[model samples]
Target: MTVSELGLLNILPILILVVWACVLLLLDVFVFPKREQVTPLLSAVGLVVALIYTIPQFGQPKEAFNGMLVIDGFAVFLNVLVLISGLVAVALSYDYLNRMGMARGEYYVMMLFSISGIMLMTSAADLIVVFLALELLSIPLYILAAFGRPKMESEEAGIKYFLLGAFAGGFVLYGIALVYGATGQTGLTGIVEAASGGLENPVFLLVGAALILVGLGFKVAAVPFHMWTPDVYEGAPTSVTAFMAVGAKVGGFAALLRVFMIAFPSISVDITPVLWGLTAATLIVGNVLAVAQRNIKRLLAYSSISHAGFILMAFVTYGDASVRPEATAAVLFYMVAFAITSFGSWAVVIALEHAEDRGLELEDYAGLGRKRPALALAMAIFMFSFTGVPPTMGFAGKLYIFRAVIQGEYYGLAVLGVIVSVISAYYYLRVVVVMYMREGDPETHSEGWLNLTTAVTAVGTVVLFIFSAPLFDWAAQAVLRMF
Candidate 1:
């Protein structure tokens, strides 16, 4: 297909976001006198516009850039999720950067760029596009992780994230090279077609897929590749950490679902065991290690890892044709649940965080129930959601995943997932206990945007549960084209 035949309209959302980000960056320097104030609002406008473009594309599947990118229900669903995440991050950052003495125009610009990359990743139909999109989304986050400049911990976080991210990128590139060598194709569809015909180098293809998994595993902070998460979350500005938790996980899983289910199903026999082990180990380590954390950021970081494991529970059944659609849908719905819960919890954290990172310890939350009842209640709701308690989206998401897992007959994993949820309650509930049971003076900052974000997410986390059936059904429809 020629460049003119690429049908660029299929990716209008991604194009608008990237173009708007570039324009925003330029306007920040020359047009805006107070970038800290103007940039976030404009950045949000960009995301909203991108989101507007995205909504119309739903159920309208097409290919762009010579079949390198696809616009489908799957892409549209994740694009909306990632864009909303970016908007929330912007809201979380509005007061935070100014308070931390780190206000700048480029922060939001970098975030916009990163978000566009995530949108691209969700639409990616080629391994080359996947690798490019991975780097595009990751590089900005590395800088943002250290946005609290000169703070030793923040600097360390940036360096650690960059080093590790670069190494992971190398893994993906090498994997692509090997896969291309094995099948003589870099496009996912082409590779799958080649595999269906019996590849000349099946072993290399298997190794390549494994390497790709390793790279994406790092992105999702799966066990054994999760060493950077706790420190990075603790040291980075809390707002950036919040966005990283959702955006990175969604992007990584988008690639995993696309590449594995679409391109590598032919090798499911070889890959399924590795995925099972990853799910089990991630669940065990993420929850077990979280139990010992006193720092809220680190605890949530580990919690994030464990949630990745929960999503992986459904993904582990990707090889089973009978179960794959529902499993994929479960993963998608769970990501939305996790995003809502994570943003709400982090908003509360941001509300209480003090300069020099003073209010970060678990003990700092004591007496919050007495002093800030609404905020404390919101936090409690988030904790319950994280623990998979009822009347919340997390429970609904987990129910979908568990049902899919059971359907796949991965009873052992389903049982392990249940056990880990029980284990997670020990740590997640500890926050609620500290908030309500203990007594101490607690200080909180209440910005309009922060409070609004908290309320919206807290309410959505619960309300979405009531409508989860339709939501899950939509997710099921989203993945139908990929297969």
Candidate 2:
């Protein structure tokens, strides 16, 4: 499609964000000093504007650039989630950066760029677009992960994340080439039509799909492809880790769902088992390893991985026409639930974190309830949410996932899912136990922005649970065109 044929209205949200990010960067350099904090405010304004553009595009799905980019309900739903995550990341980073003496305008710039990439991924209807968008989102995160100069671990995180991420990218690029060679199609809809019509050799198509899965698996931090998760999550600046935990996971799954569901549903026979194994391994490894973590960051990293497993379960039985919508909606709800609670938990981590390891270890959380009751209570709520306990969104998310799996006739997977969630409770509850039951003086920085984020997320966790019916209905509407 020609550039003129690609209507601007279909992509206004992405254009607004990318352009605003560039303008915000210039403003940070020429207008706002480091101490003035103008960049973050401007950054927030840019995100709000982008979100405004996004909401209007929700009711009608449009394909621009010859179907290379499509503005659909799925894209609209995920764009809202991605934009909200970007805003929350900024809020979480503000005070943490100040406390660690790592405040800088570039951080927000990179985040904006990354968020734009995430938005692009959700709307991409082609594999080439997916790969480019993946890189756009990932490179900024690699820089942010190692943004802390002069710290060995931080430097190490940058290098490790960069190298592994590059290798994963290579897998994706090669897979795309193979899939194209096999079917002579690069766009997801084209690929779907080609595969459905019966390719001469299905081997190439199947292998290429597996390779693509490997690449996206790395992005989502699925097991066997998840080696870098714990170290990077531990080594990176805390707020970056928090952002990566949610933003990266959500983006990865968004693309994964779109590409596989929209592009390769014809090969569901081969795909289902792969996702089943991925779901089982990720759930077991992430939760089991989290049980042994001494560092809170590492624990959450594993927790993030385990949550990926739950989301992946929705994909396991997605080939069943009857269950596909529920699977997709479950994923959407789970991502929302996980994102809010993840940030809330990280806010508590930032609140208690001291420079040079003053409040990082699990032991450091002792007596938090006795000291800062509100913060500790927020942390406790996040823990309950993570454990899939009642009166929280996490429970509702798990319930939806389990029901989907069961409806898909994967009863064994559903049962195992419950068992792992039960196992996860022990580790998640440990934080609350340390905060309330144990005794020690845990030093913390109580910045206004930080406290506000915590309370908002904590309240959101329980409040959303009460109103889950409407949320799920929204999610179901979002996937109306998936079939």
Candidate 3:
């Protein structure tokens, strides 16, 4: 391999982040106090610079690290998404950490490190690389979840997440081992060649793939594996929760799609039922349970699980040759929609959250419309978008996903998706109703950074819908280059 391909430039954005995070860590200790606001500002700057580097790489796919890392339009799309989310996360974290008495440079550093891991996962072409990326992202998050020391709930979240993540990591590693034994390769391209040519140990391949699904399902918070989500999301600092909701899912889905679409396409027929079952269960359980949640964080947690189900419809249709492009495009677009909406909603949550996690109950949202009309209006738009209503990006994303499902002739799944969406509308709209119709003083931190983040996301959540056609076209072009 050429030195150029093996060196840092081979993964320029990740390399930039590594240095930036380290610098921030060092500076945090020497030059700043625990609650210094400069840390997040610097962190955001670094993330933006990294994004600028990533932006120019669009449409040009290449391989590095002896082809173990593949940078294509798809990877570019996901990396940019994660990086941009990192910027927003930084924006959300500054005031939140202060109010919670946990502001520190290390928090931002951990987040930056986690984002680098997410970016790495997007470009990973080898199972080993993906596993490493998974660990790289997860460890920092584990620390961040517990950053609010002395908070028993935060401690519990940290411990539970660590234990579950370790278990999931073990599964991914063992699955990689089994897949290697079955195909005599760990690289996606090599695995494809082995599987497509008719592996002698197809049973091993099947079992390995199943194990991988279990492992990734945990990260994406699919049903059964999603038991960790509600508790962790509720206990962790809301800022950390906001970041994980989007960043972790993006990374998980990136690896899942890269592995399944590239290495296991031939086996998709055997695996379709499993995928279908996962998506179906996730949607029903997520939406059903969310309705019972009084804690807003837990409600959104389950809501996230349901969104995962909605996005997975794209992969269900992946096996259809005629619809593959549209299916892939739909998944990509859905992720973008989910990231923006989820992040924005969480910003509102953080604004309302007080020390010791007060004011987090659904009822606490009452009278928000009277006290803070702008915030209430933004929350309403997010609620409507989450319901997949028109004039928002969520609708466009759901439209693409449903169209893909219908085109693939999975009418039952499409119907289930629609029905569950109707069920979801009840709870999502309930928050809005409480905000406008009910009466009580709901306090907010009123942090400028948090408000800015919420406003931008709310605007993007709506405005993007009008320009969604271009996004779809870009997604189509990107998906075409995936092969």
Q: Give the whole-model CA lDDT for all candidates, comma-separated.
A: 0.94, 0.90, 0.92
What is the per-residue lDDT of model 3 for residues 213-307, given as tens digits with 9 covering 90 to 100? 89999999999899999999999999999999999999999999889988998888989999999999999999999999999999999999999
Task: State each model's C-alpha RMSD to the native.
Answer: 1.0, 1.3, 1.2
Comparing 1 with 3 on TM-score, the higher-scoring candidate is 1
List TM-scores for all candidates, in order.
Answer: 0.99, 0.98, 0.98
How close to the true structure is residue 351 of candidate 3, measured as C-alpha lDDT?
A: 88
Q: By TM-score, who's the top model here?
A: 1
Report the lDDT tens digits of candidate 2 across residue range 351-395. Answer: 988888568899999999999999999999999999999899999
Worst 10 contiguous positions by lDDT, candidate 1: 1-10
Best by lDDT: 1
The true-versus-predicted C-alpha distance at residue 141 of model 2, in Å, is 0.6
Pairs of residues clashing in candidate 1: none
Error of 2 at 172 (Å): 0.6
